[model samples]
Each structure stands twice: as structure tokens, then as C-alpha cells.
Target: MPVLNPDIARAFDEIADLLEIEDANPFRVRAYRTAARLVLGLSSDLKTMVEAGEDLTELPGIGEDLAKKIIEIVTTGHCSFLEKLEKQTPPALTELLKVPGLGPKRVKALWHELDVETVDQLTRAAREGRIRSVPGFGEKTEARILEALQAQIAAVPRFPIAVAAPYAAALVRYLQNVPGVRRVVVAGSFRRGRDTVGDLDILATVAADSPIMERFTAYEDVAEVFSQGTTRATVILRNKLQVDLRAVDESAYGAALHYFTGSKSHNIAIRRMGQDMGLKVNEYGLFRGKERIAGDTEESVYAAVGLPYIEPELRENRGEIQAARAGHLPKLVAMGDLRGDLHAHSKASDGHHSMRDMAAAARAAGLEYLAITEHSRHLTIAHGLDPVRLRRQMDEIDALNTELDGITLLKGIEVDILEDGSLDLPDSILSDLELVVAAVHYRFDLPRGKQTARILKAMDSPHFTILAHPSGRLIGSREPMDVDMPRIIRHARERGCFLEINAQPERLDLVDIHARTAKEEGVLLAVNSDAHSIHDFDNLRFGLQQAQRGWLEMKDVLNTRTLKELRPLLAATMSR
Candidate 1:
């Protein structure tokens, strides 16, 4: 199988993690980390680039040595250097880092002091009070680790939707190329646009005598085939993502797709509705007393239940069926509905691309305007802007705006909201920008009441235009801070400010539930890409899906308005 960009990136990350655990050279460790980020952020496939004989060294942050490693990974589907390092280090140490609050230092400490090399060992130590005995760990730390371990044990391993995308696309394309395949669709949480997917459910229609099952099992990426039959198969990919494929007759394609693409609760609800209508719904077809009625298309399936087609994203049984019946279903916001992106970054801060490059990329992405919201002085790691630097960048944007035609750049700052609810930058400086995207970057573990007040106070600032990633959660890596989301949503409405659905795959904050609350409270949400690189604008697609899943319409999205329409609304928020 071809090594996809994500696969290559993961290998680099593992190497970095293992090296860090071994206390290897800081520069060497940093190089692999940077390379991993560069690969993940690239819009093109590294395998294709390698096949075209492109000079990988020409890519920023990738040197000759890394270039050779990329080639080896792409051509052979494995990295010799990573394998050697894994042999040297306790490979499980890398997995230990996945525990929240456990970094390389702690992993190393645990391994050396407690002889703990695995989660199971660590869990046993924590439970036995051995973890607190480690020099740096205390009773509270040990308690938190134990709690995290319990949650981890109970949770099913799932990949972020973005992480699963390339694999699914590759598999679907492969299946579609099968000689006898007539139709191919991936269903389940993936089709529903869930934040993370536990597994892939694929449905296909093939001609009689097709050898699709054989071809699927023989695919290069298949690490193991658990089961195989004439019409169905299950396999685990090399990356450990499980996949189940079902080959259905052309007449039953829709029924199979609907059946497999489901939240079990949603499917049960539909089946109950079918039962009331004197109908039977199954993977084969929707029937009335054994006479097949509707199964040719999803639309027909919905029609059989006397309802209009419900989008996969709305099939979570979250009042969508009722809305569909009443003809009140929202016209979910589409990617094309956005005219401007109100949150983005440039190289002036932590972003990778220059202002001009980011502006050009946004224009190419069909955006009429893009906000350059660089980080402020509080975020030193990002080389965030001080007043002097911000002013210089604003002047630069003014010059670039004069030269640009298709796109306009809005001056903005992602100012930090301090623990005391004060803005990182003074109002004098923040007032100069077209937007102020306030964010909470530290103290994520504040008491619920304090956290809620902190955000509410920040929103009280006249210059606060939007709260970026309101929940401050990193999907899998970090849990959201304890805060009153309903109160925050209500405060935003009263304060005439907005919240953001930050589009970074790992930081898809303002999750669907909060987004729905914001929409219901008459508070518009900005589905911003939070783009750090030019290619990062692509993340807006995921943001749109998040918004759609929240039942947001174009009207509920702040950026869907024309730039002319947006300016007044923004100005109103910044007014005293």
C-alpha cells in the first residue's frame, strides 16, 4: 500500500517521541517534530511527490537526511531509523506520553524509578500509591493519573475524523476501481461527520461474480483479515484502523448504506417508525409484508416513512426526524456560504506562511476577506506580537491591501484572556484592529465558577469580537475546562460578541452541543479555520461539518455575511 502523508507523519512523530524519552539531542528531537508537523500540514501527498522524484529537501524544515528517510518510508512503508530507536527505547514509553500530564521527563522517571514501562504498570502503581512516591509526583498528581487511567480503560480507541480521512479515501478509491464494483460508499460516524470515528463501515454494490472480497483482503495495507466471505469481510489496517466491508446487490444498496451508516439509536428510531407504518426496514430492503417497497435510494427509504431525506449529519436522532416531518429542518451552512474567515494567523506569530502568502491562499480558497489574527505578547512560544510588532504588521497589511485585488486582509489579534478576565493587550491597541479574537490559553483547570466568570468578564470588553475555541479542549489530548457553557452562550448574546468553532482538527472546540446552544440563544458562531499555515485553510471544511452537525444555518454563522455586512456587526461589538 502507498504510504499516505499521515502515515509518514506518524512515523516521524513516533521517532521524535522515542528520542525525547531517551533524552536524545534537543535539536535532533526538534527536527523530527518539525518535520512531522510540516508533513501533516502539507496539502499534497508525500508519496506522490516522492514518485515524481521531487526534491524533498526543498521543502521547508526538511534536510537531506530527512528527505532520504521520507523516501524510505514512502517506498518501503517503514522507517529503519524509527525501528532502531524503538529497539533501543522501551517502545511503550511513547504510549505513556498519551496520558495527560505525563511528558517525556515523567515517562522516563516512571520507567527508571518504578520500573513502569506500560499503562498497565503505571495504573497498578498509581492505584497502589507508588506513583506519588516518584520524586516529582505528588498525591494529587497520582490521583489524577489514576482517574485518567480509568477513563482511558473505559474508552474505545478512536481516531479523529481528519486522521481517518486519507485511509478511508484510499480504500474507497481502491474499491471503486474493482472491475465489478458499481457503487461504493462509506457510512457510519464518518458519514455523519462525527468528531472521531471508531471504525469504518463500507458498503458497496458489485456485479455478480465480482472478486471484490478477494481483492480487498489482498490489499497491501491490510495488516490482518479477521473474517472473509462471499459478500462481507472485516480487516484491520496496518495503522490499526478496523474496517468492515459489505457487498450488497444494486437493488439493496440504499438499504445497506442506511443500515450501516447509523447511530444505533437513530437506526432503532427509524425502525420503530417503519414498524408503525406497517413496514419492515433492514439491510436488504424496506418492505411491506415481504413485498419490497423502498430500497433503491436513501430518498426512497425516507419517502417510505413519509418524510423528506435527512442529512447524515442530522441522523443522530437529535430532533432531526421531528424537524424533517414538520418541514422545519435547517439549511445547514455549506462551505460556499462563507465569504470571509474571521480567525487566522500569519508568520508574524506562530503561523507558517507570510501575510501576503496567507492572503493569496485565502483568495484562492474563494474567500473575499481573511482576518490576520496573530497571537499577542502573552504567548511567547509563538513569538507573539508586542504593541510595536503588531503596529508594524498592521502597517504592512495596509500596504498589502493596496496591492491586492481579489482579497482584503483584516487586521486582528487573538489576544489572550488573562485569569483575572483582563485582555492581554490594552484597549488602546486592541481598538485599532478590525477584530479581537480573545482566547483562554492557560489555567484550563480553574474551578467552574471562576472559569465561567473569566470568560464572561472577557466578553464584557468592548473590543472582544469573538471567543476563539471557547472550551479550550484538544479533542483527544486534553479535556475541556470546567465552565458553564450555557451561561457563556447567553453572555455572548447579551454582550453582542461571538464564539468560534475553531477548525483545527484536534481543537474542534465549541463542540456540537455548545454550538447548538449558541445557535438557539441567538448567538452567531464563527466557523473559523484558525489556520496557522496557508494550506491550513482546508480545515474550514471540517469546521463547516461541525457547524452543520450543530444545526447551524448560514444565518447562524457570522462569517457567511458579505464583508460589508460583517463590518457593521463587528464594529457594533467593539463599541462601548
Candidate 2:
């Protein structure tokens, strides 16, 4: 019955959605939405703080009323306000908001006009050509809705890596503390460092008498126990994340881990190699005619098949086996390799922290330099900087750099790439900064050719250093913009510009495949924590995960180089 941060956030988000659909006050709806974001972004556990009798109102955007609501939900596992809102409006209407082009207004229209309550109902209306009859919804909008519905139906729900980490780490810690438990490891996509995971596959080794299954099924977060056996248990957490736990003997531990931490194709390929060698491979062990051979360690399993142990992130059967055979597996980039982050924001823009606070946090994170890339003037909602303001900020950074120790601030702007591909700020202003992190802030639905051209043209700018979040994807919520990434990578290579592997959980842009493609094309990537707050510097880990999955080595990363070595490379991007 624990009310986790995500749980509270979801409640507030739902309340906001329902209220918006009901035509509630805009300020009230916005307050709930902002509260949800503040709760979700908190680094500490609200439940633990609540149990410790800490004041929840200390959290930004959480007023006295919201603080009481947080305490109530943590104590009772429900929020009365959200429950009442759900009663007033069909909760399913919130699902309509998830459709790509449908906003709260569109959802309200559909609900009030056609009585559409679910995706199925919406689909029916779309198919019957009835959605077009709704005011503000035309044939094109209806068609787009149908397309989005089909995509949603075909998609499997995935938890963002950041969202899943806490649950997985807590479970591992819990099991590790159990009596007679020898080892516990989270496997599957999590172990592979995937950007999103469907579920958790946990493996543990314990003494013969250990009551591991019972302990797992009794965990406080367990919403339902699907099945339980002496050595295995399957349960769904209150957050709807499914977890499967298996206890294996020490002898089969590595094999079991390998089997479960699989890209199924990778396992099949290894099993096929085992077959070629007159051996059988499975979760239990690698056997040569039932005379158990390698199973105690992952190295032994791979050695039995004449290959070195491949890193989990690269175990996708995507040339990994071949690379392993040829002794060519990459020394993937590690978190320690980064020297600086080139994309960040502060109170000068949409960011919550001051420039000094963000720099100090970066220094604490072992970074020697960090860029302060506030948004340019076009992003008015973020209070983006005009040329004069940017100049003033540049002077401030210069003063801070002289006063600070151990860290340096690089002046930069996340200059919006206009629809026609021009930088938001004039070159006269851009020339003053250390770097320019160009990005697309709007026009997400441009045709593939147009989008590609738009980005390509932006890169031609003398000051354009890195292409931030090249695809502009927001994980499950927003599909990546249509653009030719391969062409973009090639252009970057020719222009000596770099692309960013933005570390934000929502937009782990320049995803695994694209990162790898860039590496192969000889274009370096900056795995940047596009941090808006000091806590956001920790997001670099997720970025590193994405880079690792892309087969990136330290040399393939632009930010891994020391400042002495990096400045020259960055200078190459500027026009003479």
C-alpha cells in the first residue's frame, strides 16, 4: 500500500486531465500538472520523507493543500480529489489525450459530441466516418487519430529506464538482505541498459532452505501474485510492472542469468553455436552429452563456444557474435570517461537552478566543464534569451569562471532551428559563445524531406556545434520526428559537427541504433546531460547507457576529451 512518487504523480496527472476535460479553471489544471512534474522529478522518496514526518510543502510547486494531499495518499493509498474528478468524468477520457494529435480540447469535443469513452470507441467513430462530424475534427484529423490508435494498439507498454531503476534497485537490495541469499541481480532489458524495459527478470542464488519465493510474493508493492513455486515467483507491482523472480543453485546461476538477460536472438545464436560444437546450452548449464561443462560464469559459457564474454549491452546478436569471434568487441564508453557536458540550462531559461548551482553540481559529478545552453529567444515560454540578454549572461559566465575553482562554464545557447533552418540568434551574437547547441523546438510534423533539410541547413551554420536530441523523441509519449538520420549523420561527419545523445529520461534522443550509425559514419557524439536542475546531472548515467548500447567507445564520444583537447575540435565547427 506504499504511495510511491510515481503513484502520486500519476494521481495528480489524472486529476489534471479529468479537470481539463471538464473545462475547469486553467490555473487549477496547470497547478495539478505542475505538481505532478515536481513530484516525479524529486530525487528523494516522498514516502520515506513522509514516514520521517518531513514537510512535503518544501517541494517546489507543492502548496499547503497539495502537501496535505500527498500525506493523505501516502497514508491511505488514494487521493480523494482525484477520485472525485474520476467520478465526474470518465477516467478513460485521459487515454484520448495520449493520442498523438489530440489535446484536452479535442478530447472534450469527442467526449461531449460523440460520447467517445475509450480508444475502441474512438476507433469505431473514426472507422464509421463519424469523428469528422465532430466540431474542430476534420477528415485529416480523424485519419491521424485512426493511425495513432492502430499504433497504440500494436505497442507494448514500456517503463522508462529511469522509472524502472528505483524499483529494480530496491528489489535487489531487499532480496540481498534476505537470510541465506547469496546473490541477486536484475536481468533482461534492464541489464542490457535498454532505454525502456517491458518488465523485470530477477535472478537470485540462495541456500536450499531459503524462503525466497514467499518473501518475494509478500513484498509490500505486490499488487497481485500471478504464480508462485518453490524456486520461482511472478507478480505484478502496484505500478503495474511485472517482475519474475527465479532462484537457481550456484552452479547454474551464470547460465540462468545469461538465459534470462537475453535478446532472444542473441541466446538462440549462442545455443546454435553450442549445437555446432556438439554441446547443449540452456538456462541450467552448457552440457556435452549431459556431462555439465561451463555454467559457473558468463565467461565460461562463452569460452565453451569459442568466444569471449560479450558485454550485456552489446548482446543483441547485431554483429556482436562476429565481433567477439574476431576479438573486436569495443571497449564501450564508461560513465567515468566523460570530461564535460555541453547541453544544460539554468534560471536564465526554463531551468530551475542558478548557473552557479548547476556548475557546482557538475563539478561534484566529476565534470571539469559544463555548458550553460539556455534556450534562444524563440522559445518564449522558457523565457529564452534575446541577444542582449545572452550577452549579459555571457559576461556573467566570464565573471563566474574567473571566480570559481576546479570547473569552467562554457557559454552556449540551445538556439532554435527555425522552420527555414536559420539559427534563432544572429551569427554576430552566436560568434561570442563557446558552443552552439542547435535544436528544433517546433514544427515536429514536417515532412521527412523537409525535416531533414531543415536540420541539414541548420548544421551548415558556422556556429552549430552539436545537434541536440536529433530526432526530438519523447519516449512513449511522442514518436520521433520523421527525418533521415543516416543522412544527418553523414552530413555531421562532413561538417565536423557532432550529434548529442541527450541523457534526459524522456528524450534519450540519438537512440542506440542512431548512435551506432553515427559512430560507424565517423561522427562523434556528445553524451550530454541536458540538465535543467542540479539533480539532472545524474541523468548522464542513462545517456551513458544509451551510448554503450550503441557500441560507442570513449574515442567515439566528443565530451570524453579533456578541455585542452576539446577546445580545438569545437573551434573547427565555427566559420572563419
Candidate 3:
């Protein structure tokens, strides 16, 4: 029911795309991103003012065009430039830009050199030994590029809770073993239950020893140590994510935990408050009452200043403090309440395994069941299957169902929602699918009104079950599809359709606030991982975190049923 300020995430996406699109000044684009980070930290809605016709650009860091876009979204629910920009960009090329470390500069170079517009072509070029021969590329770089490409292709776009949970547990496991370690806990976005993890933070109390920090970094799993010190250490795990470990003394453990387990800005505001009270705050004890009255303990630390424990997602240095001060902090969802995964893929589309492989993974995670929604014919690069292939996959599911044990599989399709919001597949074809995860894969650069209408039209589909990845977000790469999400969520609820909380790291599409809004509207959510491989099914952890961060619960979700029960939910639409 609240309007979100998408500026920071928006700016990061656009600036990266501007780089890949090879449009605009690199410096100016960089300004948008720098501004985005700062703005994302601010909790107020730029839209409310924009809707009042105020020039939001007067706010430091926002430019005129950016202000205009804010106005457009607030007023009409879309951005013109983002829409135009997307229209000009080939969706295939946009997906290509998502390869980590491969910016628009490199993408443009590849496009210019090999005339390869898609990942598949680029992969072929990299593998057959053609890409490295080009200027600005060589053997080692080529190998790394190919490896990244292989990862992008071979891996699922998302993973589930079952896969990431163990790693989170293992990462937590390692920190607990540190000598002198006391009360170490996982923090950052993960603790808040996000849909994906970029890094892990562990807060603990040690004797504050150099030897302990050294031992912590010297652990066998430590692939590379970025920094090491008496009370702090940063290292990379086998996964490329960064992990920051902080240590404090026993007396100050809780204070240190609150400080180090911070979303940074959350800590900063507390320090500022401490400063206002003539106290100094750090990973050490809260230096108030001069005798350092506040000893270690997050509650004691917050209680020292009179506040409740803040959720990490809400801790983005936003209005959380003011809200907490007023006893109005937003309630966030927790992972234990999530039921099942909705959007997943198998070898059926561009996935690594069969439907049975995916369902088994879900069951193992104690999930009720899963919806195997493979890509439709529109996504040629993903090898979206045709009608015949679709039928064959259904038969496969039926065969597996007869022999099934616990979790069941629902037959679904990630159908393409065209620029006009029409189903890319015919009604007859759509009629057979148990669930439809429709998405916009093309013409993303349309005007605000059109983009909103485009999506709304798709939701109007009598056969449509869920809107997949409502925002079409690709973290660090692409901007959201220019559509009015709150409006669409409201519309979907009215239409008896559900929205997807895509668990993919790049496209946690139904982000926290949006998911919360859907819940308020009483719309059911399909928390899907969009997994293309067995590993991706594990992204459900990230998805659950995200959904919880938005304050979603098990009852708000639809796919938490056993596969047999879920099938009827979808098939009932046909009967209607």
C-alpha cells in the first residue's frame, strides 16, 4: 500500500545499462549511480513530492531527467527514457551484459567484433577459440570469460533455500569455531532473509586477539584474505562473495554485534544519536554514562538508547530510525513461514535436469512441492520448447507422478507477455498449462502508460496464473521493466492471479515492498526460483529471505501445497 522510491536501485541499473548501451557520458552515468546509493539510503518517497509537481532534482544528487522519471512513475506509473532505452536494446544483449565483470564497454566490443548478440553465440565463440583472438582479449582473460559464460549458461538463474541454507550454515559454522569467539551471528541482507546473497557478515566477541583473527583467516576454506587485523578480517570463500568478520571483547560483544552486524547506515544513525548524547559508539562498548554503561548485546545496545531491534532490509539507513523511535517499525517476514517454490525450470526449457530432479530437490528441502515452469517459445536462446516438446514434458511429469514419493510437480510455462500484453502463445496452448509465469521479454522501452498497460493487459489474460518477475530486475545489470508494479499487483489480486517472488539473484523481481503490497491486496504470491539447474532450486533461501523481508507469510503464498493440490489450483482456472 506504500509507494517505494526505486531511485537507488533504478540508478544503478540504468547507469550500468547506459555503459553497456554505450550511451551518455560515463561520468554523468556514474553520477546517477553514486546518487542512487545515497538516495536508496534515504527513506522518504520522492514520488509523493513528484506527484505534487515538486522538482525532486533540487534534492542533492538527482538530475532533471531523473526527477522527470520519478514524476512519470508517480503520476502515470512508468519512465519514458528507461522505456526508450529498453526498446533500443535487444533483450538478448541485455542478458549478455549480466555476465559479471563484462560491462557495456566489453559487451559493445563483442557486439562490434563477432557480431554475436546472444550468450549462446558468445559462448560458442569463446569455446571454439575465436573470441580470444580479438583485440583487447587474450588467453587468460578468454579462459575467465569462458568460465563465466559457462557458469551463466550451465547454472540455473536462481537457487532455493535448501542449497544456500547449508552454505549459510557452513559459513556460520566456520565463524563459531574461531578461538575466543563468543556469540558470533550472521548479519547483513542475509539475516534479513533476502532472495540472494552478495556477501556474508559475521559479528562476534573475541579476546580481541591478532592470533584469533589470523586463525580465522587461515582456515582451509579461506580462498583469499583481503584484510586481516586483531579484531577484523575480510576474506573470499570458494564462492566469489566477500565475508567480513568482526571481533570484540566479551564486555562489549553485544554492542560490537549491533555495530558490526550493521547495514552500515543503521549503525551510523545510532552513532549519530550517541554523538548527540555526548557518547562515542563503535564496535567497542557504547561509551555513555562515561563508564561505558552499555555492555555487549544487541538488545542492550538498542535498549541503552531506547529502540527495538531493526530488520536488516529496513536498516538501509532509511527512515527506520524515525519509525523505530515512533514505535512504527515495519514488520518483516521470516523464512520459517514460507511454503514452497513456484517458478522453476528443468531440462524442459534451458534447465540442467528433468522435472523429477527439481521436485526431489524441493521435497528434500521440506518444501511442499514446486511448479516446473519452463520458458516458452519466445525465448529461443533458452531453448524454449515448442508445443510438442511441452506435451512430451507433461507426459514425463505424468509418468513421474505415478511413481512419485512426496513432493509433486505442476506443469507450467514461463510464457512471454508481448509488448501489447498479449500472450505470446495462443489461448489453446495456454489452456493446457497448469500454471503460467508470464513475463515481458521484449519492447521494454515503451512509454510509461504503455508499459503499465502492457503488463496490465497480460494480467487480464483469463488463462494467466502469475506474473513472473514483476519488475524484470537484474541486479547490477538491467533496470526494471518500465511498468507500475503496485498497480499491477492490485490488478492481479482483483483478477484472481498471483505475482511471483522470483528467487533468482539477478531478478528478485517481486522485491520486498512489492511483495508486502501484494499481501495487503490479498493477492497470492508464487515464490519461484526460476531454477534452470538443480543448484538454482536452492535460491529459495534467497527468495524466502526476500519474501520475509517484505513481511510475507506461508498463507500468503499459493504453491506451498503438495504438487497434487497445487495442480488443481491452476487447473481450476481452466474449469472457470
Candidate 4:
């Protein structure tokens, strides 16, 4: 068995969850949690490092004990520490952490008080009106729990795109290395760049004698082979992500790719277009009666239906077909189009790296300028900067810029938008910065009207430049705050401040629908990494994918403009 970084990271996270549920030391729990994050964010493979006998303790937040645990997980595919913790607490209690509003503390309370060790037990308790009496849980909390549980039950388990990417990329690389394989591609929601992916649809064009299926099932990470055939096979990975692989002939590769890389509605719409033209479309090819019309390329498939080639990200049947027909399809923003990132952080706040390191990283990532937006005073958990600390950091950035080249660092703060709609720090200090990435770090449960008003009021500030992670959502964990997003977009257009399409995988907020609405409203959106470390800049690709899905073009994105063009636009937002 090959242990990936995510495997090690998951072990650490589960250890943290179990520790928390046992009411263990908070610092010990935080240490494991931090170790998990560090593992997940590493660019290189931990297994490779372990194989090379590298010292893991050199990694941030990875101390002597934690380094040993990492080696144990990598070498043995299990963590003795986590196994021990699981024995002290019901291992299933960790699954309760998946429920939106339930944290480990709540799980512990449920376990000790209500004897609720699983979601099913919690669900029954909530339904029987027994949860309301469980100390901290009230009737409303119980009701919300029931609703959340039901939603969870109804939803298919989908991996966040970030979580699934490594597995998908590793598999693609493995298959590509197999003898007789010509090409391999992962197409599905992954191709569409959806925030969460249900499964991976992999297609390979191979020589007739290819042993792709045999090798695929034999891959180290494959947990179980569901079915196997010469041309097609299905399996589940160790992480439980289902994957389907198909060996396609070169002649029909494009058609197979398009068929599998689909939103069902989009595929149906394309098929109907083919039908109207007296043609048939399927996984193999597009045909007019007995003759094949198009199937060799995705462009040919679209041309057969009298449409231009639609980008996979736009293949959601969301007016894309109509736009293509009218020749109004957007060019769509790409990773190369971005000129700078407006929302980022450093060690001055909760970020793991310093401004100098982050700048060099942004330059390496091809950005001409990077904004170091540390969290402001209100977020103590992040060691957010006070006005004095913020000023000192600004001075540091100014000095670093004098010694640096290629990339410029902009001084800024991710100042909290207070409950009453005022900035966390006073305007006097905020006005001194190049930008303010105003955000809501707390009070996510406000009424729709109040939440919208709070955000709108914050944007009213002359110093406010962009709203960071505008919905404050963490996919599969935290739901988006209740608010009128269209109203927020319209207000942003009216007010001059921009909304952010935060690129962080967990917080791809200002989702595709909202991004499109902002575009429609003629409001520019910044597809920012909201990066906390150098590796986070890689997340910008996810943001770009999200923007493409929203039908955004380079001109529609704020940060796509060069620094010279962006400063004036940013200035307009700040002094409006």
C-alpha cells in the first residue's frame, strides 16, 4: 500500500477529532490539526520524503512526536496514536464532526449525555425531542440538527475538488506511465471545476493490446475493483472516491470524453440538438443514420450540432448553448490572465509564512503584485493585527519591497466587518493601506436581511476595497450565510467595491452562480487566492475554473488587469 500525503493528513485530522471529542488538551488537539493542514498543503509527497529519510520535524508545526506519527502513518498505513484515541471514544463520533453545526464539543456532550454516538442516534434523539434537553442544545438547535442530518442523508458524498485533485492527478500519471497507453484525461465535475466532485471519469486512448484495466485495478491506491473489462473498469480508491476508466479508440476519444465529461442536463441538451438535425449522439460517436458525422474531436461534436466549441467549464446548460448559438460565448478567464492577488495573509496574522516568502512565491506563481492582507484586531484566534501591529507590518512590507524585485507587495488587512456593519479597525488606519479585504469572521447566522445589510453597510466605507469570501462558506462543513446575494452583487455594482471569488478550496465563495450574476450586473469580481501560504497560490487555478463556470472573461475580473491598470481601479473603490 502506498500512503499519500492526504492519507497521513487524514490520520492526523482524525486524531485531532478523537482527541477533541475526549476533551483532551486543547493545545494537543490544535497541534494535530495544524500538522494535518501542513501535510495537506505540502507540494512534495510525504511518502517520498519518508522514503528518502528526510527529517519531517523540519516542517512547520511538525514537532518530534508528530514527525514520528507521520512516519508511522506513511510506513504502516495506520497511526497507533489515533487508534488509541479511537478506543477511548467511539470512532463513529468523529463522523458527527461532518454534520454542519456539530463540533467535537457537541459530539462529546451528545455522547456523555444523550448516548448519541452516530448521526443516526443523533437524528432519532432530535426527532424524539430528546436533544433539546441535552444541556447546551435547545429546541431550535435540535430542529436545525434534524434538518442538517436530513440534507446530509439526501446528498451524495462528494469530495472537495482540492481533496480529489491529488488522487485524480496521481491516477492519471500512473495510467499514462503504463505501457501502450497513449493519453489519459480526467473528465467530470473535475473537468467542469465544480467545488465538489462526486467521482472521477477517466478516459484513455491506448494501443489495442493495452493492459490498462489490469494495471489500473492493480494500482496501489485502489481499494476495491467493482468491475473489470478490457475497455472499461470501475473501482473505488482508498479514500473512497469512485473512479471509472474507459479505454477509447482514437477515432471516438473526443466523443467519449464529451459524453463522460458532462452535466447530465448539458449532455441531454446537446443530444437534442443532434436529434433535431436528424443525427444520433452517444458515447461512441455522432451519426446521421448509418454514417458517422462527428466524433473525433469535441469541436467536431459541437460543429455537428451547429455550435462553437463550448468550454467544459461552461457546459452546465446554463444559457451557454444559447450564447454559443448567438456567438456571444465569453472567452473565459484563465490562470495566465490574472495579474495580482488582492486577498492574502502572513505570519502577522493567522498565515503560516512571512511577507517576504509569500512575495517570492507570488512572483514564482507569475503574479506581478501580491497583497498581504493580515486579519485585523477582531479575529484574535488568528492573532489578527491591531492598528499598531498592522502599521509595523506595513513598514516591514515597505522595506521588503525596497530590497525585492519582480513582485510588489501591497499593504492591506482582511479587517472583520463588525456585526453592526462597521469595519473592525477605524477608517483612519484602513485609509492608510492599499486595500482592505473586508470579511465577516463571525455572526454568520444573522437573518437574511440583516446579513445583507451588514455587508452592504461595510461596503459603504470609503476604505473598503473588496469583500473576501463573501458568503463565508466551507463546503460540506459550513453552509453559506443566509443573505440576498443578488442584492449584494447589485449593491457592489452601485457602491464600487468588488466581491471576491475566494480561491481557497474550502471557501470557493461567491460561487459560480453569484459570480455570473456579478458579471451580468457589470460588476468586476476578483478571483483571489485569499492565500495564507505560498502553496495557496496554486488555489488560484480553482478560482479561475470557478470564474469560467460563471462565464467570466478576463475583462470581467478585477485582478486580471496589470498592476498599472489595477491601482487606479482599486483607488476608485477605496475613495468612492
Question: What Cα-based lDDT does every candidate model obtain?
Answer: 0.91, 0.91, 0.70, 0.90
Question: Distance from true position, residue 385, model 1, in Å?
Answer: 0.4
Task: Predict model 2's lDDT versus the native.
Answer: 0.91
Model 2 scores a TM of 0.96
Residue-level lDDT of model 4, residues 388-414, one tens digit each, is: 998899899899999999999998899
TM-scores for all candidates?
Answer: 0.97, 0.96, 0.64, 0.97
RMSD of each: 1.5, 1.8, 17.8, 1.6
Give the number of the best model, judged by lDDT.
2
TM-score for candidate 3, residues paired by index: 0.64
Model 3, range 1-576, lDDT digits (tens) per residue? 112444334535664575547666766665566455434433345655665767676554467776765666556645576677667766467667677557677777888888878888888888888878778888877788788877766754432222234445666666677665656677765665555556777776655453567776776556799998766799975434577887667887777667655677778899888788877787777885667878556777777677887766666665778988999775654555455677888766666566777788777767766777888898886789778888888888788888878766777788898877898777877787777789888776688789999998888887888888888776644567767787898788778788888876567778788887888899878777777655565556567667766766667777655555666767765444
How many steric overlaps does candidate 4 have? Answer: 0
Candidate 1 vs 2: which has more lDDT? 2
TM-score of 4: 0.97
Error of 3 at 418 (Å): 2.1
Which regions in candidate 3 have their CA more than 4 angstroms from the true location?
1-178, 189-202, 208-210, 216-229, 233-245, 264-282, 285-288, 291-294, 304-308, 317-334, 561-576
lDDT of 1 by residue, 13-35 (tens): 99999989988897788789878
- The C-alpha stretches of model 2 lying farther than 4 A from their native spots are 23-35, 53-67
